[model samples]
Target: MTQEILRAEGLRKSFPGVQALDGVDLTLRPGEVHVLLGENGAGKSTLIKMLSGAHHPDEGRVLLDGQPVDIRDARTAQRLGIATIYQEFNLVPQLTVAENLALGRPPRRFGFVDTRAMRRQAAELLARVGVDVDPATPIAGLGIARMQMVEIAKALALNARILIMDEPTAVLTTGEVDRLFAIVRQLRDAGVAVVFITHHLEEIAEIGDRVTVLRDGRSVAEVAADTPQNELIRLMVGRPIDQQFPRRPAEVGEALLTVRGLSRRGAFDDVSFEVRAGEVVGVAGLVGAGRTEVARAVFGADRYDSGQVSVRGETLARADVHAAMRAGLGLVPEDRKGQGLVLGDDVAANLGLVTLRRATRAGFVDLRAQRRAAAKVAEQLAIRMTGLDQEVRTLSGGNQQKVVIGKWLVAEAGVLILDEPTRGIDVGAKVEIYQLINALTDSGRAVLMISSDLPEILGMSDRILVMARGRLVGELPAAQATQDAVMELAVTDVEASRVQ
Candidate 1:
């Protein structure tokens, strides 16, 4: 029988305006992956923080091997064989891999720092996590996947018995995700208890041993890993999501946005596609396949060495974002927090950012007009918030995404380019976003969506375009597209350039 390594009972934590966690319970046994499922603000982060000693639960007891203990800080948690790998890594980028691994506890000889010993230990830890890199290599040079491996190595170096991975695969490619899962399974077999958190419902059956669902800051359900997907969705959002993708039939009018021979040297090359009015065009590819690069180039966020981007038969100037915006184009960037939304501002402020000039009257701002526009978009997108004045940073992931999309709606953009539109958001929010997409296309706007989710691409897209090695390799109508067909074009080379 497996032993329960960590247990939390009736965990309750409260911030000034929010009761982040209300009577949450969790039990993690050695040699099993316990998936923690919840929408953003459903208290998953709060529970994890409490478990990792970043926060103290108001009313709860945490047990280690059935013995009650006080976890006052991160240091204390680490000492007690618990470590957390957050979505955003905790590694110092300026430092070398070895230095980062031995951050708090460096090897010492005769009261002097022992660099050689530290490097040796770091090398061993890196190998254990299946990371192939020099110990002396700077952390800044490593990619997201490698950085994650380093984090796991650091945790293992600290002798962690209970590992908490919070959205570990959120930013990874398909291949990278598979490798990470292998490492996770290896750790589980070695008797490490892992608390995994993710927004992707498909990942549960792939790696999880058991599942726990949280709703409105409470533990709503716990089930076996093999539970049906619909039941899990029901427990999570308090309703059954019968249709995951709410796609309407494409109207397929004249091309609203056309890209011809679009090329960004070293990023993407000879990428060409057309998004018709009332149509949804999806760009699908593995990471580093230049899907995002193509989107950015078309939107004028990045310079394209060679290309013609024409909207309604008018050619746009190269690398000019203002021109793109003025030509009825808007891009919801992949990095929503960094490029999409101004997190420090309130909902009204962010919603009005793209349309501020229109809301201005002869050197004076119209607050009423801004608020009205914000209110209209907020209602259209069903953005859940305390008020229009609520800071964007404090909102949930789904609501934050809505605000980003809502900005374009307020801008009256005719062409919308969305990169990773449904990434890192919950199922309920995904459905809502899909409904919004359908609404947009139904209203005769063109949508060019770049997504990693296969089902999303197949369901919402009128036609799917696949990229490989920075080139458009294939295209398929939605009726003819399958996961296998898309994956083939995404990864492998084809003799012919396009798939009609």
Candidate 2:
């Protein structure tokens, strides 16, 4: 029999009011990719947290190579050859690639920092992951793909036997993703056990060997990826879901938001688009196509070197988030934890963030009014929380996203820029968010959505714009949108084609 690299029997975890994991069982075979599937709040995150030592299992046991192991924390997990690469990287931007690669285990000589040796070691590690980057360069200078490669290299350097990758391709281009897959295949051939988690169905067909379904904190079933996509979706979602996006027809009104010749140096250039009230306009592209940058520039969070933005035909200045907000623009950023909310704060405080001025008297927060307003918004969003006073960190990924979105809905915006709004959440919450977006348009709000998810853009948007290398490559009406068409535009060079 093939060796079982890792095994979890009757694993369980519980919080104050939620049983995040109830008797979950997972088996990882050597040299195989085990894909975990679930909706948001299905306890998928909790199970991985226990595996990576971020959380202790309330019951049952974990065994590595047929021997029981106690993983108390992240450090202990790392020491035990279990390495996790989360959707969000844990690299220090200020440090050089070499320093980041050799962090905590840097080579030292005569009590002096050994920069030369560190760079050499970092270069070797990067090469192993198929990344050709200068180790001496600071991490902030690398693109998102290269940064992700650095993360993979860091894990490999620790001699990890079990690798956990969450949404690994969410921010990667086709070329970069192919290279990463090559590395993953290499690891699998070398007898490494990989636990893969993602929402993209095609990825499961491409890389997965065995699949396990989790629903509402319990293991539902396990199957081979060769099983029909519809069947897999049914198992993951716990029901038959036909074509994920269900968009409703909304009458388009006058142009509520407009951008002409929008340019942000080294980011997006000449991004021009218009959105009418009661319309959903989607910006689609491969990773690093400047979709998020365009959203930020239009929302006044980032400066545009040259551009023209108009709200109902009135010109507005760039690089002013507060001005944009006051002018009826709301932005739901891509990185929720970094740009969305204060995770340490309570739900009430987070919900009241944007409208705090109205709930404050002479610079002092009116606690009662803030709490009352937050409760109302929470109730409307259907956020599952014990109460308004609960900490934001305690909520699941879907609820946290709801809290971020609720902040915008509380203060109605004429134009809402939602970047990757349904990312990292489950299918159930995705449906809720879709309904919420529809409700926004029904209320005469224009939505500019940025997403790498092709099906989502095709389903939710009235029209779609595909970007490639900081330029808008092509435009497609929703009725004509297709995945292959978007991929063609996303990979082509727009400037070279114009010359042709």
Which predicted model would earn the best lDDT?
A: 1
Q: Clashing pairs in model 1? A: none
Tens digits of per-residue lDDT, candidate 1, 1-500, equal 67788889999988757788899999999999999998877988889888889999899899999999999999999989999988658999899999999998999999988999999999999887667899999999775557878887887776679999988877676777888899889889998999999988889999999999999899998999889899999899998888988798767788999999998778888878889999999999887788887888888888989879999999999999899999999999877886898999999999999988877889898999889989999998989888899999888888999999999999999999999898778888888999999889989999999987788899899899999889888999998999999998887763354452
TM-score of each: 0.91, 0.94
Question: Every model's Cα RMSD, please?
Answer: 3.0, 2.2
Candidate 2 deviant stretches above 4 angstroms: 109-111, 130-132, 142-145, 364-366, 498-500
lDDT string for model 2 (1-500, tens) is: 78898999999899988899999999999899999988777888888889999999989999998999988999999988899988778899999999999999999999988989999999899988778889989999886667888898898888789999987776666677788888889899999999999877778878999999998899999999777888987887777876578788688999988899998788988888899999999998877788887888888888899989888887887788887888788999877988899999999989988888766788898888777778888998999888887899888788999999998877767888999998787677888899888888998988999887788889999999999999998999999889899888888887788799
